[model samples]
Target: MSNSVEYQQSGSVAVITLNDLPVNSLGLDLRTRLLELFRSAVADSSVTSILITGTGRMFCAGADISEFDNGKALTSPLIPEVFNEIDACPKPVVAGVNGAALGGGLELALACDYRYAHPDAKLGLPEVNLGIIPGAGGTQRLPRVTNLKVAMDVILTGKPIKAGKAERLGIVDRIATGSDFLTGAIEYTRVQTVSKNSSDQIVDFKGNDRSHLEDMLKSLHPVREQSKLACAKALDIACTHNLEDGLKMEWALFKECHESPQSRALQHLFFAQRQATKVPGLEKTTLPRAIKSVAVIGAGLMGGGIAMNFANAGIPVKMLEVKKPALEKGLASIQSVYESAVRKEKMSHSQAEMCNSLISGTLDYQDLADVDLVIEAVFESMDVKRQVFSRLDEVCKPGCILASNTSTLDLNEIAAVTKRPQDVVGLHFFSPAHIMKLLEIVRGKETSNEALATALQVSRLIGKQPVVVGVCYGFVGNRMVAPYSREAFRMVLEGAAPEQVDQVLTEFGMAMGVISMGDMAGIDVGCAAAEANADEWKGDPSYQALQFKLKELGRLGQKTGHGVYIYQGREKINDPETITLSVELAEKHNIERREIGQDEIRKRCMYALINEGARVLEEGIANRSSDIDLIYTNGYGFPSWRGGPMQYADEIGLARVVAGLNHYRESLGEYGELWFKPAPLLERLAKEGKSFKDFQP
Candidate 1:
């Protein structure tokens, strides 16, 4: 046997221990060696039963997903064949689930005659998370071993269940109570009688099975609609066919889902997210500074949310404000948020109390003197930021890091106000910071590697995906979104209704259309952001003119129920007044009104984002194309199925993207020349017939 697997016989039990460290994923070499050992154990007359367990916390993570791209996944003695061999063995095979048994890992457990899992082990078929269903008899066997509801819940939701819950659901035969899991499994395997395999169990598919399947489908809330629908269809086939035929049918459906555009896009993001954690130019040996305590400035929604992230990470945090009333109000707001979470069962009361206890409010900068990190979440004005940073520079400790949560301002300028510019960095968190996953760590010209590394480390501690980006307006996400928002506003002025524009974007897989997003985010906020960069819009008087008009009329979005749309409760009703306002603004700006098609709206907005992303790369604002993809997918609500705008551009081919930009430049006339001018990098790549995937850092 290979080193990946350790084979030995304990009494009558042939102990086959998986020695692969880390996740112990089913790679080609590991799979081949495990099968060889299993067949040897079956052929030996001295071995009575087999006990299979892993070396570490993970019994198995799953099949090595990277192997699929390298063609090793299709090599001889595939994962299914190994499972089939175990199922056919004369000696009973017992699985000892030491930890997480996810995807193919859970499927392996099902092939055994009996399963004994550690109490802390987590088991589930989470293949749908990668845009594919369980192809290794999981769909057919899970329903046979457990009830249909449990199977549907496991496969559809793709969330793990603890061993206690798995035993309750009949997914696990028993939970091991001892400290040494392998010893307990060995003793249990020696005493157990031969049991029926999951594949040989009988299931009833009687009385309106289709209706039952539909009802099960309705209860599931998978991330991807394609995965949800496909898994449901696969389950229906599994119920209708025998074990041998059902495995074939399930494999076919799994292949269909694996080869889909949605699968490809999701897989790309899965890898890209891991890649984003690695800093390009930073040295591998650089160590991150310790962040023991944190302080957050400002006491508004953003400030309270930012503080909660540290508190949740088990780090004590202080919220600072200039006045007592603001400090009291902010602390009260934070308590209310924690209370709401407990009320909704999002977090247990004890967990909420513990996290809430770690947070306190203060009215002085001196209280932040001992803090390891200070993040200013004040207003967007540069003058206010400079004043705050200057004060923090004086009050903070010698090595304490000072960070600004400015979404669009220049980080280098913010760093300049501080005497310790090397310790200054940008930790831009999205609104409702405790919930949003994306955190853009902006690196200034003078920012030290230790500061950047600390930001990245702290981001992981707070469960946020950190993307290291260079100093620029809006960094990566907001900078590229500027053009996307511009196109949405311009289309409304040219004749598309706000609802029509929003509908096109949502249909194209944006979580929310740009128009609805602007309103949801507050129209006044948009106007303020545009005004912050007023010098850039000097030549175009019509730029964001409609939103400016809306702000003047006090129609500041959902808060007022009358920004660009009339909001009756949660319903978005079209407002004739908004249309009238657009017409007036269009004529005042001397812009022509014409009917716009759905395809045009999508192309103009998407291409604008893609073009700007290219410019961001050329300017070295973002580290890599994949980094931009991760920021957009995680932060901006760009559909993961379409990947990021850069990946989407690659999918359609860069030549087509450049061609579309040039076509618009000639058609939209002056507006096209101003906004649709292709980035030089994009144009050059198109000329060379290369894609963003080919562009190195």
Candidate 2:
């Protein structure tokens, strides 16, 4: 009654404005007000057409997340009622979409007879990423409004379609110019609203003849069915209601998702993702320098991947490799990845070629001057990396942001050689940088806030999620990884075989278990990291035996056709000689071998990683729990459905986890103290019944 919804009558049209703050979400109060506004328009005899829009940057961000984020049971009779009420409105209700019309917001627009979008608007139904289908009439009305395939595509993938694409798809009636979006919608309603004198058609599908669409289906069996079934289910769920009955069906599904265990996890994940970027020192963090062009030093796997990421971001890259053959191979690898995307239909041939043209290879240091940023992705050796940074400091522009793609090197040492130490930052791009969604923005002590923000923006441009991290050994990923690997070693010392361990973990939703993952990543790398730590753990005879035995054998990994398991054509056909050596070495030290249960195996691997993650948070290495989750989910293939380890910890209860860590702390003693002891941050939060969100970045 107090104007939660406001009416601005402009001549022949009645404009209903939703003025709720912060993206104008359609929550319970807004829903009630929406009903009142529709009734007001209906009652006014002068109102011929209705133009509904929002008084914010976005039309709406869908339902209020506050309603469900706290593990609430979703009750029925939800969004469907609202949608049906819109459909039942006798007058033409036109929607003026501006900015993001996502989730239930898009569904609200669909309830209108026609939709008008601004040039910069984005439309999407992103429920699937949260582990729920479109519960609102999205499933039903979308297919009827567009073709079956187009509806399925929008629902399944959850990617936003541009205003131009939406108009072409007939999802929007028209695309408006840079004027008041509502004015165009009102004009459209004048032409479209039907009276007794003018009969109106209830159809708006006007898409191109996609008759050849079926031929694009996958030729492969399981992959074809996997794609087809996923698409079909998206539409099938939508067909449960007609336009008038839409609201009921939509609310029912929405409620199902609201009460789902998956939804609970996703809500935690959403909060975690928000936390991920919040590391301390953001107040002083400078944006990265504008990266229009980049120079990459080294053409090895990491360097090539860095170049490819820049190319994909539409930044011109001059890749400088020391040797001719190395440069050729790096460029070839970039081509191969792009070619694979085309073959898989992830990209068009033209688009792939465009991305490829952006990367250039050379052997000259003179090529570095014009670039805004120069990232050295050479060997992991400290001296080599320091030399590269020194050269970049001399040759590149004074303002050029310098970066090292080192997973474990010190950013301070790298920056010490550069004249402009503030410009130096660590851009730890995971393997196959272009494909990975994470780019760790590790700030050195002198790195400014503008540089940090610039790095965050550039990361978004390059299609990556950036998490600004504090400078430390191993940064965040490898730092936490050390404890996770320690647990893996402890698992081996116990009676569980590598295959058994892998099976238990794979079942937990990882793509591969720890042992198989080691083989896939090359055991030589892990052994190298361990050997570097040999002196630190010298007093512990057990660790020295495990490290030297692996180095003694030629069982490096799949690259050498042996590691944790022997490989034949991507198949592990034989048990590894290194594993037998490890077992023998353990027995010789009189280390007791008791068969560890599957639950313990899973807990040791996951909890160790999670415990270290908390430690990283306490030490200010990572900004937020969500940032770590983003790194793991996108970079390390941690299953999105379960959320990241931080989210999983919240779901499983931090109190329970703390107790488990305490158990390990007592039994495993000193080695356990290094990896098994839960962080004080974790202990406090658990005891207080709080969450990772309780901490500041």
Candidate 3:
């Protein structure tokens, strides 16, 4: 028997404990051992009942995804085969779910005659998140034990439910209240009557109204449509087919989805997110500095949102502004956000009040002296940032971490102004910082491991995905976006309408088009970022000319009700003036306007981003190719299903990407020749018939 599974006999009950450390994943070895143990218990006349439990916490997480790509996942005694054996066992089997029983784990429990779980245990079949449906008996057995609606919702949404909810839904027989979950399960099994398998039961969905489900299916965004289709198909099979046929149908569909490009991309992203947490050269033993109280330097929108993060995390936060009125306004903004949540019933009034109470406002920097962490969320200006950091250096106590929420500024330069460069880091939170999940943690040249570790810890405490990156102009995300946005603007100069550009990107699965994103982010904001990096855009005359023109005309964006398109409340309508301006700019630059195809528009914008990402990878600004993908997916609204720009490029084939770049370089003349030159890394990989995945940092 495999060491991962331990078998012991207690009276007439055979207790089998799964001992896989760190979440018991049901790999082939564990499945084989479990099957052997079940067969042994059945063969033993003394053992009339079998109790299955896990050592430590986790009953099981799911199939060993790390072995999915290899053939190990399909090895002998597969999960379903073991589950079938358990169901066929003459002796009664009870599953004691002490922790998370997700995906195949839930299927294991379903195969048992009865299941009991710890009060805090979670159970669900979340295979849809990996772009695949459950392959085991989850699709059929879940509907058998629970109603069709409940089963469909659980499997389709891929969300875990608590033990209490699971018991209420009849998915679990009971919630084990005692500290000894195994003992509770064993005791309950002793009194329970032997029953037919769950598969013998059938769910009646013929009279059920499925309009709400259909509406939910239709409401899914385009990027998630493929996964939704897989889910819908699985649910249909579960409702119509018998247990054996339904499991077979689900397995076929699961394989189809597992082999799809979307599945590969989503799976890549899943692993990439985990990889992003690891920083190279940082010792595992390096501990983070303790962060108790936090201080925000500015009381503006960004400042207030930053403060709300700490407040939500149960950490005390102090908001500082230059004046009392500004401080009061900032505090109001924070309160209004929490109040809206309460009004929407997302939180209770007491919870909102408690969160607000954790945040206090001040007008003086001296009050921040004792705070463990100080984050400067002022304007995106170097001089302003330097001044704030200088004051923080004097006022903040020793070992205090100083962070700047500068999205694109040079962290090394900002750290240069302070005596403790090791203490300075960049925590670039996305807009509406309280809601967005991505937090780019910029590590400066002189940054200490302890500081970086602390920033990563704080990011998690505030519910953010922290991607540690090297310091550079625009960092990893914005630097690549610079070329992408440049191509979008240049496409307009070549006679592509703003709506045309946006439509192509949105159709390709981006959350929004470049034009709409520009309007939402504010054209003036782009102009300011450009002006801050004026040296980088010095030679390009046509760079962001339309945005600069719009800024000059005071057509900032949605804030001013005019940008690339006119805004009527939340609706954006095309404006002839913007089109005329683009034509005028083309004529001023002595460029001929020509009709651009949607394919060309998409290729230009996406390739520009991909090529720049290669440059970022070559420069070591990003640690790995997948790190770039994580930033684009989480921070830049890039489609998670397509993976990030780097992964997308790998899917498109590096040789093909290079061919497209070279075609644009020769065809579009000077501007194309300048911008479409593939990065050396991309060129080398293309020449060698390789991919971004082949490049190791």
Model 1 C-alpha lDDT per residue in residues 53-171, reported as the tens digit of each score: 89889998889888766233488788888987787777889998999999999989988888899999999998877888898888888888876667777988899999999999889
TM-score: model 2 vs. ground truth: 0.86
**Rank list by TM-score:** 3, 1, 2
Residue 522 shift from truth in candidate 1, angstroms: 2.2
Per-residue CA lDDT of candidate 2, range 396-456, in tens? 8878888888888788998999888988888889877777778888988998676676777
On residues 15-49, what C-alpha lDDT tens digit does candidate 3 reach at each position?
89888888889987888888888889889998878
- Candidate 3: count of backbone clashes, pairs at least 3 residues apart or interchain: 0
Q: Could you tell me every candidate's TM-score relative to the true structure? A: 0.96, 0.86, 0.98
Stretches of candidate 3 above 4 Å error?
70-73, 209-223
Ranked by lDDT, top first: 1, 3, 2
* CA lDDT, every model vs. true structure: 0.88, 0.74, 0.88
Pairs with steric clashes in candidate 1: none
Clashes of each: 0, 24, 0
